[model samples]
Target: MNFLADLLDLILPEHCAGCGLAPVLLCDACALPLQGPARPARTAPEGLPPPWTVTTYEGPLRAILAAYKEHGRTALAAPLGEALATAVKAALTPHHLPTTREAHRGHDPPSLVWVPSRRLATRRRGHDALRGLVDVAAQRLRTTGVPVICVDALRQRGRVADQAALTARERTTNLAGALDVTSPTQIAGRPVVLVDDVVTTGASLAEAARSLRKAGADLLGTATIAATPRHHPA
Candidate 1:
């Protein structure tokens, strides 16, 4: 099945989602920036769980994410999700991962909980972009022997203004009290990681962590494919 998909991708001549110059979904040039080692997100908000990102969100990385998330370039999910899987591994080191005995006791693999997209945004994009990426990331991790479960456990509790034009502080203020967990039992007492496509001010990640903690989640960390320069200035 995987071979067939790869063959199809080659046969279809799909342009690169990042640069649109290479004859592939993600060309080598664009993928290079996403190959960085995952590192602790230095801009994590004071109260949020430790977060990790694989690459700086700029240039091709930013373009790829925007295309996947906002422009309906669904194929970009594979590469972006794989990048997310890398960040997840870095966030959950030996000390952070759940013990085998603990996993057996709970009868649940570690959870990958994604920040939910706004209903309107999902509708406009014709899909839940971040959720799709989380699902793919979980699959990729499992293939490499990382037992994990992707859970659609977070939901938007209210509307929020677009964050693009907002400052870091405004983004934090706009997201306050805006998220809620769908099920406490799913996360309660489980080692979990929050997932998102990108982190800017960390406002969304912070809110998601708050809701997870309220649900009794043993939230280990957060993971994303990229982080904006606002958080990692040159």
Candidate 2:
């Protein structure tokens, strides 16, 4: 499966989804159509702020991410993780400092916590996608001299339905209170960032953030690979 997947990626990439491309998932010309996100930072849903999507999901970015997550493209983690690190650094420019343990909305420390998938999902997929990216992102952060901490301290409290077939409201309700910190002592009073694949309604991140808060960790905003566009016209 892995060998075949790799071969198909090389020889059979479709045209850019956002723009018809010259026989590639996305040509260089169209791969970076999007600049950084407009409101690149946020603390909460009501306070949802600028989000940095380093690349638009139109061309190669979409294909790369989809292949990595859905198609088991583990080999692409290095480049994709580097891109994600760039996106994260771009958001942390002003206060990429090692000043204090307390993390404000804008000034975040280096620690990253992932919103864990349900046990069923992880078992079925046989990979922890967020963890893989975080590992590489942590390395990239270190190269830039940013301290990074990966705390897999959070775990799924229960299993839920496949989120893809659900409505936004369902996604929200399904993930509520579904996470908790396993090691409360270690993360106590440490600044932390929540990492995940994507943010649609912000429910999973919120629940994880709430757990971290309960365990005495400072919460920076969460980040993801992709997000559903807000307010698409009918």
Provide the overall lDDT of each model, using Cα atoms, as 2-decimal numbers. 0.84, 0.65
Residue 167, model 2: Cα distance from true site in angstroms: 2.2
TM-score computed on alpha carbons, candidate 2: 0.75
Task: Put down candidate 1 lDDT per residue, 15-116, tens digits, no spaces.
Answer: 887887987788998998777789877778998865799888888887788777766678888888888999998887754454555566765678999988
Weakest lDDT window of 10 consecutive positions for candidate 2: 34-43
Which parts of model 1 are misplaced by more than 4 Å? Answer: 1-13, 96-107, 231-234
Off by over 4 Å in 2: 1-44, 47-52, 55-62, 94-96, 99-109
Measured against the true structure, the TM-scores of the candidates, in listed sequence, are: 0.88, 0.75
Using lDDT, give the best candidate's number: 1
Q: CA shift at 139, candidate 1, in angstroms?
A: 0.7
